[model samples]
Target: MPPSADPSVSVTLAEIARIAGVGRAAVSNWRRRHDSFPAPVGGTDTSPQFALSQVEEWLRRQGKLDEVGGRERLWPEFEALGDRDAMGMAIAVTGARLGTAEAGHAGHAAGLLSETAPARLGTADAAVGIPVGISLSDAQRALVERAVSLARKQGAYETFDFLLGRWLDTHVRQIGVTPPPLADLMAEVAELSRDGEAGDVGTVLDPACGTGGLLLAAARRWAGSGSARTPLKILGQDIDPTQAALAAMRILLAGHLPERGDASWEVDVQAGNTLRADPHPGIRADVVLCNPPFNERDWGYEELATDTRWTYGLPPRTESELAWIQHALSRLSPGGTAVLLLPPGVASRRAGRRIRAALLRAGVLRAVVALPPGAAPPHSVALHLWVLRAPSGDGTELGRPVLLIDAADVRTEPSGGTQKTGRAAIDWPLLRKIVVSAVQTGGNGGNLPVGHVSVPLIELLDDEVDLTPARHVPKTTISTDLSLRRSWTRFGTLLHELRDLTATLSALELSTEEPAGQGTVTVGDLVRAGALTLRAGQQPADGAVRTGDAPTDSVPVLTVSDVLAGCGPSSWLPAYEVSAGEAAGTLTVTVPEEVVVVGAYRAFGAWVDTDAPTVLGPQLFVLRVDPTLLDPWFLAGCLRAPANARRAGTHTSTSSRIDVRRLQVLQVSLEEQRRYGETFRQLTAFERSLREAGAVGRELVDGLTNGLSAGRLPRDRR
Candidate 1:
């Protein structure tokens, strides 16, 4: 073991693969083929853990350590600490050191080594506001030094941001991050509401800040509006102490960014439950932006029933989001704006109706924008943004109108010839433009966007007082004549395609008599003989898979749903290919031509993928067959046969899952295999054509019914 190695630290196989910049399969292969491989120290046989010291020594001797990045090398050590809070503290310490060095405070480094270092580190400690009673170990201190060195090489801000992003990725389920697009949109909307203000934004607050994503976005917006030199004050509070500390470090570092100008910042972040304890009781900010936790029951409802913040009304126990809204309203100065991302239920839930009515009555609610799904956290639901303005304590604003805009249909079409999923990628740029325009124009009738409407406060103060934008926005009408003609044209094209497919299917010939019995082999046999290689798709870490349209750096992933449906990839994952002697951990296996992808659950099916370089998703099996030994299409067809499906299925009450190794395929000559493969391919095409025709047939019927009822088409049709 190396002198610095901690014998107590052990790493899982996945971590070892990440450390060596290889796949998990490669690590397993190493264990099987190499005699010098380290033995498992602990954990179950399926997921054995190896001592970090031994693994490090082995990698060093194998020359794999040469290409590993400094951050990747330190990650295992941090994970071995077995405490997320300590990992966060170590990150905070590293950020403090970087900030100190960047500001030319070399003397403070010595102070950090002393017993009173938290107090003597000066601005570094003041900036981060390190938590009390938490001290670093000797091993942790050494890790911090290495992190500081890395920051020096690759710009302090960049290195810190990378580390923070990775940390967020690891604990994605526990932390809810505001998606960048939504964050930017919220900032833009706030800016639009405050248009023509005399100077820069004075102060901004986020009660449930959650690492200060909203506040940071607000700062960027202010800087982009050419107010970079203006002084800004940011306040935040979170229940997690580590998050509060890290948020402080992020804001402090943002202030020093060269492109953001020399804006002096007064950042005050505290660790406590914001709803229970009001930290900034007396200060009113110019802007308040928040994306608070949803549906929380125990948000000090019992104890704080009479808390002065509930000016709108007493929020019910089930309406924690409403309480957050009122809390945001209380933090704003008169005429100041507060933009909050809230669940759609708060707009119309029975428990929140009273509070919603009170807000509309006060003329405080400015606009309600309905965003597309996948725009933010809880990506499956379409969330709403309530833009509220603290009334200036005047009766003149009592009868103001509220703008309602529904941009839920604003999304990008999937790219790279991939099939669409239930969720679509939000077109942030278009959404921003539609929303900003609607808010700026107050959604007046003239030339307003399709889903924009301006409703009077009196009109909205009905019995329910539902604030859902979709309910109020008028549905767009289609031209009867034009739609009828377009439907007819599409119907004709689909009929012609269907006819050709039917003719092709009819041309194929088959033998009437039963053929001689053929030899068969199991998939496991073929894999063992080197004629096929089976690879299981890995379940990506939470927040790692990108749904909808693929980004430039991402690749389409072939999911089990895609395999079962006989379609293309429905989602994407980041590509971590080795580039320029650097590896971004292990490279995900990209399916090549002739690869057979099989669905492992719900049903037994197979797809022969001709598209190369598609990443495989979880709950699927990729079978790469040797062309000399097996035909890919023939193998896929046999595996998908009903008899084989029944034999391989593991039956349960809900659904059937396939054991891919148990699937059987016929053994035949290559020429015979090619003949059957061609027929199978033709049948697949016919099935797709039938589905298309069915969809078009429905459209045709609907169009005819509407046209005849509306007198747009003559009933005689002579």
Candidate 2:
């Protein structure tokens, strides 16, 4: 295969592995085994690179083209284009074609020309109706055709989003990509707030729309709500010109195409700072959703000193988030809703306290929701979403209660400890439902749901006017009779469990003698001796049915979180399930005498004793031990020790990877190892008992306190 003229159009080994849907070791093996494999055309000796065109051709010849995705194949060509403006314009143009395809066949207007020659680089430029100052090669044209074909097969939305998501993922370190869950939640909040309004929401706006994520979410929500036929106008403004163009394209591609004569929806995307340059000064929108840049000091404060948007009060220099809030609020029509994602600090910051108080008095600040960290970008800190409505200036409306939702503890996992590498996984659908439901039922002076409460405006107008949801939301309330009944039942259950545990502990014969180590054997030695085998799990693909309960399918997939939490397989996605001959593919079939170890050092391992076959999720390591040679539970217990965890921590940085080969195992007979495993099991049971007892004890204290605080129980005289 002839190499491309440009050496810049090459990928790293890791990228190649991702594109090929295989392990990095597989790529290395291919390079060594095949003489026809593309030779290194660039990069250092430590990390050689191959020409993308040559590599792609070789993969096709090898019948591995099916392994590579369309987006994966097209990205190298996109990178090769090299002009940022042209690339943005090209993406937008492709998005338009996708939109046209989504709209149904519309002849030449939809770029439905014969496939005699693939659309060239200037093709999207023509579609965009502008000059992007770039030309396309024949290779680039073919790449575009492949992308369009893939989009057609995958459905336009999924394909477009996949490409956009990958692009964002690649540049996340340089420019923050708003986490999809957060963006969707913000849009849902805005949509919910528009409920029971005077008119339908036809105009949606996002002033600092980074890449039109918020607007796209809004459009999706509208489409899902039986309004697909309605034409909704979208407006976006951003500081970066390239980002602005991309945002315009995203909204255009995402819109519902007209079936008959022409498209009804109108899009206007401007490239300018919203605060410094008020591009759409006089236009008020029905809904505004924004995840503005936080802590931006140089936001042209001096130039906007006399701006009219600051109706309540001028935002301080340190409170740029407050400024974004005002800008969004100013853009909302009367009784219209706006949802803004901001740092938690903005809710209770001293500088913005007066403004918060003013907004509350005016009834513009409707709700403040505190989200858990890792819900959005800047995953290190928890953020807040402020729900606002343009004031109608009615005194009775100003007296209404404000809803506060404290979702700081709402996470897939408990937030007591630090995560090793990635942020905690989120249940986005559940989160959106919770927030929207809370907003709908809140502030009626009636009963609120758990994790939510309504505070009277009079109460919120205190000296501080602080809006921290956790501070204001009422604690889980229990009456005297109910509290006593619940506490007694819990105490009885705990006592019974304790009694059972004590009896079981008494039956175990745990040797008090110290363990004797005749020799040390590494896990690698056991593997070399054919005493054990190791393997890892595959990541579940898109559209997979993931569950938090018992699987409805034939197999149970164990996830890393399940292992970390010391539980059996509970959650499973549909992608791993096989039908007939599909079983011959990558889905793992678990056997008896297996130990599942969490890949991170923060957590350890579990010994599988289930009767049925199972599979493992991503980042979980499986050690299939020979029962006659080594006890599975014994190895798992050894791996779970703090000493071994610390040792593993030293071998890796940032994320501690388990090097099973380096793990030291005790040399002992299988029977002796079984005895040790029994002892370990007993200890684990005791630890669990202590945790349950502690939680039950806390409940008792809370019940007693709540009963007294509410004056529902008489105080005993001592």
Candidate 3:
């Protein structure tokens, strides 16, 4: 076990990399090459822990800490707190001290010396405060003092935001804070929907606010608007007290920032289950923005059965998102607008049909916009933005039509030409334009755009009040003749390419007679001979991998699916040392050039990756070969053979896993291997062309059939 003393706390390999200001791979190399490196004190073999004191001493003796900053050195200690909740509280406490210091409170600036419990700041003042009744451990106190000292050198807001950003990055999955782009988009949509006569949104509320992302977005939006001088009150509630405190501090710091300009903003974030207990129930806001928790089953259903907030109807027990929706609607004042980011299912789930009908009939729900996949959390599914308005108590708003905009197809093309897999990036600017324009003009008797539809209220009151935008938005089409011509042209080009590839493959001659003295060797022999190194991919560390298009600062991850499809990495993880260094948990990242093999049943394949550094995902094996000893392409080809697959496959009722080391390879000279590798490369290209041709052929047939059925094509003159 690691020592319990404060100075001898345990640290992971990842934390050591952070302290040394180097990549995890470097630390891994050090461990293997250096005799003086600290030994594991705890944790499992895969993620071994080392004593902090010994590691620090080793690093200092090696002169590795010379360029490391104080903040960087303190971070590992902060992370050592172990408990995420406690770490968050420590960060919040640090922010509070910085705020008090900025406010000229010397007593509070003494850094947690006084025993006075921290108080939650009221909404009336702009003071940043910590969570009430939370006490720091001795370890946390020492870390906070170091943090405060750093804060004094760097501005308080900058230091606090830096810590908070790092915390959010590490705990991304748990926190699920709204992406800044999505938050800004929501704020813009709300701003567009507001009534000009309301004299600017005086107040905003995020009932399910995680870390005040939406609130801050609103503040930035309104600060730049005509209402820049207006006082905006921000109210928020969360189940986690630490998150609530952090949210409050974040907003308070934003208010004091010089760039935010003398805008007066008040914020109060209460901690509790917003559904079970109503903290600000009596106060309605001019604007409400939320990215509520989705599909929660235990969201105070029985206790709030008769709650008056469900003006449309009591939400179904299974449809907790509906409850949040109704809560958002209830919190809207007369003519107030609310923009909610909800899963697409909430718009069309059967259980919420009645509530959907009620909202439509009462003209509360205004519009539903379908965002592209990867726009926000739960990124695999396309989420929706439901724009709603509180009834003004007049009948004039009752008969208005509901606008539906489907921007799900609006996505930026993948960055690299070779990247054929992975979620397409959401074209936020285009999405914003399409959605905002549609919302602003759809209800004003304007002709709906191609992806926009304006449906009457009575039309949605049918047996199923499905509000999914895809079901209602009309599909775009080209003129039949033009479409047919384009399809034919594409088909012809694909066929020409396929024909050339087939001819080239057919011209390749092979000896049908088998050699009597053929030599075969297993992959294990190559590794034993020091000709190759095999590393099995590991499950990435928690919160390491991100789904969707690769960001500029991220490295692509090669998954089993990507291997099977013979495509580039379908997912990516941030490449910054913070996350990337720990991406593969205990395994170092895949070597720059290697042959990657998938090991799943019926999905086994191998490919040579010559691209930039890529992280190997789980259930895969990376083979780094010595160029002089083995040809990577030749080895990949041999491993991908069907006969070799069966020979190495361990079959079960469910799956057939390939034992890569047991796979057989032909013993051949390097020159002969190069020749075989070239042939294999051509074969792979031929297969790809065949698949492309088949797809184009299908499109051609479908177009011709549709054109004929629609009587848009002339009959052939025989």
Candidate 4:
């Protein structure tokens, strides 16, 4: 537990959580509960602490060696993993084993060392089951029990998340993504710091800091560079307390100090929402790196219509992304650079063109670097990085030259990532080198001779005022029917992947009907269970509505954009908030949503967990379960199954958008119900690794099309 003098080796509790795959409480528990837990033998408590060997030994004793086991195994195995999923699995497994041992459960831990099912978790689809206190079809009930028993044997039976088994998130796809590369953040930071005075406040900040990924990289690079990153100030803030705390812990564990430390180099993480209440509202930094929430709609548009941060244009009611852009711009001091990760639409989309024009006319726009898809949390789409400078007049730097990057043609790895993350992570090194070269070119961060044209800022004022990178960047060739060609190719693969996943879901849903089955009863019969609760939504003061068949002008509908901005029409909401007063003038209001649904999920018939005040739509059926008889979290694991999605489609009530009553008709035993939850818990972790893999894959494909030997994969059929 001793701190490291190397500085590069020192880390804190939060950072350990990110690297170790455990919560801070778990780390604290290890420090407090285990007498032999590595104690900081030397170095200041505020500095990089812990002996690597000691920590490793401790992890080993706890059965947390993670797969190949031992320090000697960490690198070779990590390097051998030829796929991104495999790499993430390895990292997670290592983190888990390290954690399992710390929790004194190492003996019960299993590893996720590879993508092949057996290489990680057992290679079998788990059984179907119902949520606690809810009934299930006879077949599903039996399956649930079987899974529960198996999961108990594995020993991890209480941590299920919905995204694991789902092939793709309907929500993520519907919302889309403009994956900004972590490399872009690094490249921009590096660009700003090139040849700058030492100890000249080399810092990076993120308003909506998620996991502190960008911050960690900057910190690590600084820490490792001897004293080049002097007094490295890395700061991050978020609206969600959990995310902020998580980021804080993560930053500390990266061998740096948290906000509690005296050194300005100490972590500067804050707990409240950044946008609504800027904690360091007046503090401008040398470099600003951020990937704010994307295309938010109804983002409290009415409330902050007159905020000062709206330097560009009044972002339309449906344009939260633009607000973030301007907000980021406001944070930069003159000569300070801001690199923002944006979605593709933000660049060329018609609606926000004027605001884009205004920003460009101001000469703040530096270089627009294009990135392949699958870079950030919502990793299914392409993204861009906009590098803007605070109009520095150091006498030489910003009068006429601005780099316009056309990186869509860069070479990529076969598995869809840049070269830096090895197997399938973002190629931060490649992109960084490219961008740094393109922007600051001849300076210390030498720019590569890119085929960029220095068009006058006035050119951006042409009728379209379009900022799309593709517009200015030349294409080597063109297929007249690009869309048609995409359709022709992806037509089959998309259909196949879709059909296969659907079949899997259907198979999971098939009921074993036998004389109405034993323990089966209608939802009305189980009204006494009280395991499900309904939160039926009400009509908004000026609500717009829509059904799947027709696209109604239903108040722009409940899009992901709305939800990310805190006002979307759905059962689930973003895990964040932007508190007022603590922030600068610009603040957004959360809009009330319309409609709600009663129990209509899988195993659990409608009417569940509705005690909290909420706004739900018919798409979400409410189910109230008996806590005494069932664990709601466990039951929810089963209810969110693919099989359930299919079953709900048919068994659910047709009126008012599917209610929960249809689910209880299927008989299920409480014993088996618990099993489904256990099984889900067993697989929940794989979600991150799986998605990371998919993200790498998506980026690889995009990068390849722009330049690759794999030929080309088809586009998604809309």
Candidate 5:
């Protein structure tokens, strides 16, 4: 229990449950049973909130304060800031103060200042003041000090990362955090610029630098081989001063943008609206990276309509993304490159077609890469990355074909138990390699991987310069004869397997008498008795850079989809390693003998017997059983029963959520459990065989029909 400072801040019941290390139901029980519990301070009747100070007092009296961390304790004050925007500003202010304090400790005067911050600090230098008009109370200021101390104890980079993540988590709806994979991909793709290859990307700029993630990524890329020759100059601007300050702090802490006194580093980060106010007007950079606000309806359309930056054409109000594209283009030095993350709609939006056509004809639009959904925030919508380079005076690479990469099918790490948070994990390193290779090869469409293609400039410069990668990229088409042959072979094998499984299923007999019931227990009970353990899988918090040091691409992640479909491993792999000293909640499976349950979907459980080491993905739960007391297969079979699923499930129109702890299990002797396990296994084999046969039968029909229609296989003329 840290000292209670603010009683004004309030928290939701869910947050209270999270802090207490108990289920939400437990918190509800407390409020209902205890008359002295804090009354509802805010929120609806369905989800009442409580004052943080009162809740802390209550928890302390109940001896539950020890369960919450100091970081967790600070969340109520943030939430108490009243609105999402205010919370964001508060976070930024705290981050700036933290940066300044770190700098002061290092004995520097200017010490990492954001343009938004007050030029001079008062005696209480560590105190953070939000620019969003909400002043922090004395108690709140003390809370910030404690957070800074914790952050300082951890490395500066680590502390900023933690704070940034928590901030994003607190306000995920109002803002978006670019997943590390996508950010890295953008940085790598930007690095394909001529200057980048020559190891002389001297300047980097991000107009819409959200927490400075893209800029930091660029900084890492520019510092080639960890010994970059050119001293990098970085510039960034954001609409929110708080976020801008946080971004400045993050970059400064990473040491990419050193303090003002440092000789090699030159950094200028301003807090103002990028679209409305040109913070770095007329400044050209070697490389530009931006993930601008998407579908901005009020992006100074009328005012900027005649601005000189609109070289292609006056962008329609509906096409603010195009405005950003042109803005990046205008900021580029001749032959300099810029990579911008845009929505898929921008490529073919009717309003932006003219601008797209113009850019394509001018040879400034180099490539369009389609990324899978969950590549970044707004996870459901697939996004596109446009790589552009300013035309040289001689126009050497102008007429070259544009590269189109359809990487929407790139693999992602499996969510251990559930698909809970963050974007769908991507094989970032592999995707980066694929995008870079395609760009360098002049979009040749030569020996390119499965989902990439290179199309001629003339082809793309048609009536509408539609640059949708999937539309241009060639789809793999096989000869009808070959398709039929493969389908027939697969069908034949499945039929044979089905026959054997049918016989085996028929031969297995159930005992006429029921085994004596040993007892009944809940999942929590078993866990308490040390007969089983429950573990949830890991996911990187919003904007997190790998849970630990392990690279996200190398680790295998078992996702909920894999468990439901009984597939091997999902394509997603976390950048972090399972064996690394990872932060808690980092999803990795170190144990094999466990039942992986899909807590959010239809399928509830499966016994994972695979040999590959895998991390558990989100929305998943793993139950590890003690072999001496319980049969793993039997427990899995019991959990899979429809009755158990029905009991645990809280169904809705679109999906269902299961609370595994509430599901009941029939306890029996280990030998009896084995008998049931064998029976269940045989039945499961029968079900799988039927499914395989059905799938193969459908494929066989489709292939035969297609083959006959295409005249690739002979058809009887009877």
Candidate 6:
């Protein structure tokens, strides 16, 4: 016996059994078979215990463990294993359950256990289509059927392993991924099956079987060893070849095919569009579950204007939503049931009104369930699940209740990127509880199966059947005004800061003064005095001029307005940056309001000097004026402040920046311009400093604070 397996050193058989969730008999059987299993050091023979590791090791070496990649695949086998059954019995039980489900219900339950098909499903075309009448090789068919049957037979334990193998074989990548885990699918299926109508399961079908996600769930519910009707003969198809392959693998796991072995399920997967081709052609099933893509265009409308799928009415060229709805209807056998996903807009959008009306008049619109947004995404718009039936063929119909379910009321934001899986991106336990309850209680436009209030049909019709969840998730007493709350916090902080800043400002007597006062010196005069150097001419680098490499620094690259008036931030500032590698001798214009100016010369903006930094095309010039006499910000603001910006542009040369000579003529009162300009200049300067300082300083301080808290850094300061 291995040292780790010495019973006294580790957990005993009783503890191990409890931990592994198995009974004493199962633990006893393991010790008898494996010689390496250890007995307790001092315990008596009759009360002797074995190490837990012994059983764990034996299970691993014996290959009792599975490598199924997903929870859905492993669930069936897990459930069966927990029941203390052998592999063959587990497979049989699971298959029997799936096969025994009410007609179309198997498809949905099966889908839960399998992968899903493409969101945009249809009769295969060239995008994925091969010639129609073409059939699969006999061997392929057998392989596919066997996979289907095995998938049907697989209990919770083997489901993961089977699904992993199937997923790899199928080459699937999830898009528009769903929420809620696989466990929820099983629970929901079980919940639904419990409400079964005595003995009336007709046939089963999934129009859109991505990987038979829903079908497997339904299959497990009905096919398991129970007091139910015969196992449902499974049928599934997908437009995507890969999805078809996956579906086949799931079915094979369920023990579906005969004699042919590995070649079983290939016949189940046809390579054609389900929508346009309808490969099943004339077949009908008792139940249809589909998660068809929403609002897609390009379904070859022009070619099939008079197609039979348009039974309700002509589908608008722009609306694929209506076409899919009608298509699902056309395939359902009379008295069959179907539950499908749809964008909530389909129920209320004007473009789909005619189709909605037709479905309504036909009485096939069984219920409109309003689900939480992101039920399936790309959009957070509330979605709807349409529960439908083809008015029971033999007059066995019940009430015409819509069962409009508004499940959005129960959701919370995800934290740490941990999204809830399936339908609504909410917690599974909660989602399962709500979904099962809704299914059972039939609340909010549902027939109460148990303990929940039922909304009347008249109530649904009241507000144009607005199946939005907000209308239903009853209002609570605590109404939180998120926006208002934020505003209050902001105002409180602002008020506190204002009081502190007022005290500080009172201490500094910063005076605004004209450099030359009422006896002012001109910007041109200052530039000429050699206090400032103009940016020299430079061509754009021969190759592509990346925005990052464009220059700045040495010469204050002033735009046209800066040359004419001054500078500041403005729309026409040249955003493409260049290094100040070499100081240019000419005035350089730039997009930045203070650093450079845009010439509103021709029509919009411009600069004057030809030798300065200029726009590549036309209507711009850079003026690198000395910042000695006039502040860059003050000058720029004076020039571009709406009225002044327009005024500066009026003095422009044709097809170029505003003429510096014409601008120089316009007298800007050193007193008035500086009066407002100084305060603006200080604010702009302070703002720039704040931005340049950025969060790095604050982050460093935060790190120091954290380090001090952790006793790594001292908090002492002078």
Alpha-carbon local distance difference test for all models: 0.72, 0.67, 0.76, 0.47, 0.68, 0.44
Compared with the true structure, the alpha-carbon lDDT of candidate 3 equals 0.76
Report the lDDT tens digits of candidate 2 across residue range 1-718.
1224455588756557766777779989999999988888865443566787777778778877553355666676666675554455456556656765654543324443222332321121122221123344565565556667777666666666666665554444445567667887787777677657624777788898888888777766653332446566677888876576567667656554343223245566777878988778888888898889989999877888888888988889999998899988898888889998888999888888999988987888888898877677666567888999887555545766788987765555322222222124555665676687788777443432336878888888888888899888765542234545765787787777778878887797767888676676887788899999977776655534233222133355667676566444554433213321134445544666577666666555545444335566676767888888988778887877777666755465536677767777788889989988887766666666666677768888877786677786656788
lDDT of 5 by residue, 1-718 (tens): 3645666677777667867888889989998899988998765454466788888888989887654355667666665655665655555556666666665666653532333335422221121222333355554466556666666554555655666776775455556777777787787777765644546677788999878888877766664332334467778888876677677666765662343233233456777777778867788887889999998899999888779999999889999998898889888888889999899999987788888888877888878889877677555567899999887778787677777888776645444322323234566676776777776765653554445776887788777768898887754333334445766787788788878877777786768886565666888889999998897766644543222112222344566676566644544333222323132334446455577777774656655443435666777778888899988778877887777777778874327878888777788888988988887777777677677678768877886676566565655789
Model 4 agreement with the true structure over 1-718: per-residue lDDT tens digits: 1112222233344434433566767887878888988777443332224555466667768865443222222222222333333332333332222222322332433332121222222111101110112122343333223323322333221111111111012122222222234643554454554445323545667777754666765665553332433556677786644344334434443331233233324456665656667887887777777778876775667877888888888888767778888888788777777777887778777778899787776767766767644455344355777777665655444344345666554433333212211223345566666666655552223334233445566677776777766678554333213433543454455455555544544455545766464554434445655644433333322312221111110112232223234322322222111111002212111222111233333222222232232333323433445656555545555444454545545444433223344443334566765665454444443333344445545654564566444444566799
C-alpha lDDT (0 to 100) for residue 575 of candidate 4? 14
lDDT of 4 at 505: 46
Top-TM-score structure, candidate number: 3
Comparing candidate 2 with candidate 5, which one achieves the higher lDDT? 5
Worst 10 residues of 3 by lDDT: 106-115
TM-scores of the candidates in the order shown: 0.76, 0.63, 0.81, 0.42, 0.63, 0.43
Instruction: Give the CA lDDT, 0 to 100, for residue 641 in model 2.
Output: 75
Quote model 1's TM-score.
0.76
Candidate 2 segments exceeding 4 Å error: 1-69, 72-90, 96-146, 149-158, 173-188, 191-195, 220-231, 256-263, 372-374, 379-382, 393-401, 407-434, 451-454, 476-718
Stretches of model 4 off by over 4 angstroms after superposition: 1-181, 184-199, 223-230, 256-264, 393-401, 409-433, 442-451, 476-718
Looking at candidate 6, the ten consecutive residues that score lowest on lDDT are: 120-129
- lDDT at 454 for candidate 1? 88
lDDT of 1 by residue, 1-718 (tens): 1223678777777777877888889999989998898998875454477887788888888887644445566666766666777777777677766766755542433223121244323342223443344488877788777778767776787767777776775555567888877887887788778645625577888888887788788777664333455457778888887787678777766766778654456567777888998788998988899999998989888999999999988899899999999999899988888999998998888877888888888888989999887677676578899999888887655878889998877775544323323235666787887887888788863553347888898878888888899999863333334445665787678778778878988987788876787789999999999998987766665556555444444456667776556545666554332110012222235455455545454645676876555666666777888999888888888888877877877874327677888899898899999999988888777777677667767877886776666665545767
RMSD of 5: 11.3
Q: Pairing residues by index, what is the TM-score of model 6?
A: 0.43
Clashing pairs in 2: 545-574
Worst 10 residues of 2 by lDDT: 121-130
